[model samples]
Target: MSAIIRTENLTYTYSPDTPFEKTAVNDVCLEVEDGELVGIIGHTGSGKSTLIQHLNGLIRPTSGRVIIDGQDIWEKGVNLRDIRFKVGIVFQYPEYQIFEETVFKDIAYGPKNMGLDEKQVGERVRETAALIGLDSALLEKSPFELSGGQKRRVAIAGVMAMRPKVLILDEPTAGLDPGGREQVLEEIREYHRRSGSTVLLVSHSMEDVARFATKILVMNHGSVFCYDTPPNVFMRADEIAEMGLSVPQITRVFSLLRKKGIDIRGDVYTVDFALKTINEYIASKGSAREDGHD
Candidate 1:
């Protein structure tokens, strides 16, 4: 897998040279492989948002470079709009950005902006609506008339309609009910699997990341804390706790169980993983007991 997105010494400062001057992101370097589902996590004010803004040239880097598909996005004479089309970003609570009268047109907005024909735009609108679990009937209603969860899905569909090479979402499941959250997260996972597009999910939910992400990028104080697979990153529970962040609850439980000499896997995060680990451990225990009795 080649690197589709790379940042070299990326840095961004807010209100530079002023009394309120602050460095939001600092000298961060990273590489996201093509077709990877990467999760970004950090505490508030840890520069998660600032770091992503630089990916598609939403925010010009104060220093360093952002390279996408082997081209520097900040290169002079580069078309920013084209870059945006290739890297779509859905901000947190993206529903607020929806203004079109009907859901169909709202979802079609991005495809239309790309100068796609009506047929192409309509196809993308319908396809993406389905991908995000929006029914065809909802496309006829006003975006504002839908429920909060529906509106969020519409906003997400709008971006997905573009079929960008890379999709970035910031806290996409925020403020949704438990069922809505699960539905949205599962839909996103399916979308990534079906589209084979690079997906960067900025989330605070360790469980979500643990279940879906192939890689995890942890940030702290505007710098890359670590970028590793879910198992490896969650293994450093102590360090994550020190940064005011936490691993999945199941991960913490298993870690404690390991500390107690339970001889169980400490890296389990999701419920499924924990259950499998426990079942295997129990089976092994029973087998050992039977052998001792023999």
Candidate 2:
């Protein structure tokens, strides 16, 4: 299948032609296949946010091209606004963008901007609100009056109401408690599953990315460091650590266990996989003991 989005040697520089100018992205080429969940990780100022912004034409690359669905998003006369509707971006603390009086209105904002009919806007709002686990009764209440988590949901629902083919979330779970983080991540996963939309999650949490992302992209020094599956990327734990990043906690634990001569696999990044491996090891040990007795 063709990539939903592709970049050709994409490069971006901030404050070009000025003494303080610096390149934020450099010769980075990547692709996002349709309906795939891609995780983006990097230290601060690694250009992750800048790169994603180019996906939907929010930032025009200083050089190279960003193509969405086989067309250059920055082509002259291309409707960038329409592109945004198809490629929704939920920024960090998106709730702060909420300006509507009611939760329903806040959620409906995107579709309304798209000139959707009243009935369609209302339907989209309610459907997306439900998807984000927003209570129906709360839809009538002022968004400003809702709790932090609820307001965050309203912001996410606003993006969902646009029915984007690709959703890019920058730290979608930021500033939330553990439970709230899980809630938001689960909701985002469900939305991706139900809609089959491509998801680009930019997060600093290795654990969350390992749990949810199908592919991982690691960036450093404003360039692509690696692009692969979680296990493949996390396998270079020491290198990742040196770069001011970390592998998932389970991966780290298994790595330590292997170092301690426990015969455990170091590549296991998820809790389920770790448990299965440990169980198989125990079973093997039990069989060895029985044979010794025999």
Candidate 3:
């Protein structure tokens, strides 16, 4: 598939030319293919937020280019509004952005703004609400009355209603209980599977990313530290850890076993892979003991 989102030497600085000037994203370049689910992870203040904002033309880069669908988003005659519609962003704590009285209206907001007729907007809202697992019974109730998780789901549904070709979610599962987190992540994964939209998910949890992301993008100090498939990226566990990021728990477990002189592979990154490795090790040991006895 072609690259749906690409950035070239993208740089953004706050308060340029002032003592407070600081580069939030510095000379970063990356590409996201059509329908690919990418996980972006980094320490706080590592420019993960800054970089995504550029993709949708929400923020102008101090230098460099952000190309969406083979077009430079910032180029003259380009409609930034159109870019925003193509790339939907559900930011961190998106629940705070919900202002409509009812969940239906809140989710309808984006579709409404796109000039969809009443019937079309209603259809879009209901379809997205269902996709996000929001109950139809809650559609007319005030969003504020809903629990925090439900509020967040409503917020996500709003973006989904827009039918963006590329969906970017920043910290979608943050500030949720474990079950709630899992629910939201599953909803997102399902949405991606059903919609075939290129998705960018910013997350802090290595386990969560490892479980779902087709690829991982690691950032450090406003620069791209690493970008690769989950297994390949996690294989550089030591390099990632040095960048102030943690590897998945399963990867760390295998690494610990290897360090303690166990004959095990340290490259395992997922629980399923770890279990398979353990079984293989056991099988090999059993075969060795049988041969020795013979």
Candidate 4:
């Protein structure tokens, strides 16, 4: 329930003082509570990537501060190595980063770098592999031999093996089939539930975020548009669209019904919720008709 990740007036610029200079992230203040799964969404170039880069200590903010686990990451003598270990980032197409011959070794790489012994690394790798739904039989096979989704799970498990306190995933499910996407996201949800570590998922899929995230962080024009629960964020359907991001398709449908003078709740953000709402509405109307007959 405490804040594990906090950014105070965080700002970043590219090509500073040059003709190509531009602010990518500006005065962004944000907080992510420990063990919370947060979905970060925005239009292209809305600073989602840059902002998260700061959290992983991969980029220095032009100004402001990035505080992780109650310590300013940039403060004097604050070790960046330690910060990176605390915040593990799995980038898009992380499969390309895989180099080890075996899936087990790929997953063991991080723990090994952390100076873990052979026995410890093996234990960590197997535990993380199982956590991500990778089979024990597949651990010995080459990472290249796995399916796209399996490769992704292996790469993600590689990061998880380090036992980071905060995990940041950038476009984690990108390019996967719908089934693959669902499997990966569900595994991520399970990982968060079992590990009790905070997760920041940077994704463009409104439905994915709506389905899995405890809270949503909407970014716009390099600023914090809003940070709230799924229902609260999706309720601003029109405003979100105006920012070049669509609400979940179901949310849009409910919004359209409201605009057409139908009495419908505007907070529908998932297919399952939409179905429930529709059934409830029909039942209510039926009840009214029965009352009239009585």
Q: Give candidates' CA RMSD values in order.
A: 1.6, 1.9, 1.3, 1.6
Per-prediction TM-score to the true structure, in the order listed: 0.95, 0.94, 0.96, 0.95
Candidate closest to the true structure, highest TM-score: 3
Q: Give the runs in model 4 whose Cα sits over 4 Å from its true position.
A: 286-294
Clash-forming residue pairs, model 2:
none
lDDT of 3 at 239: 80
Q: Which stretches of candidate 3 lie over 4 Å from their true place?
A: 289-294
Residue range 75-170, candidate 4, lDDT tens digits:
999999899889999988899999999999999999998888999999999999998889999999999999899999999999999999999999
Q: For residues 1-294, what per-residue lDDT tens digits would candidate 3 score against the true structure?
A: 799999999999999889999999999989999999999999999999999999999999999999999999988999898898999999999999999988999999999888899999999998889889998999999999999999999999999999999999999999999999999999999999999999999988888888899999999999998899988887788788777788887888887787799888777888888999999999999999999999
Residue 182 lDDT in candidate 2: 99
Relative to the true structure, how large is the alpha-carbon lDDT of every model? 0.93, 0.90, 0.92, 0.92
TM-score of candidate 2 relative to the true fold: 0.94
**1 or 4, greater by TM-score:** 1
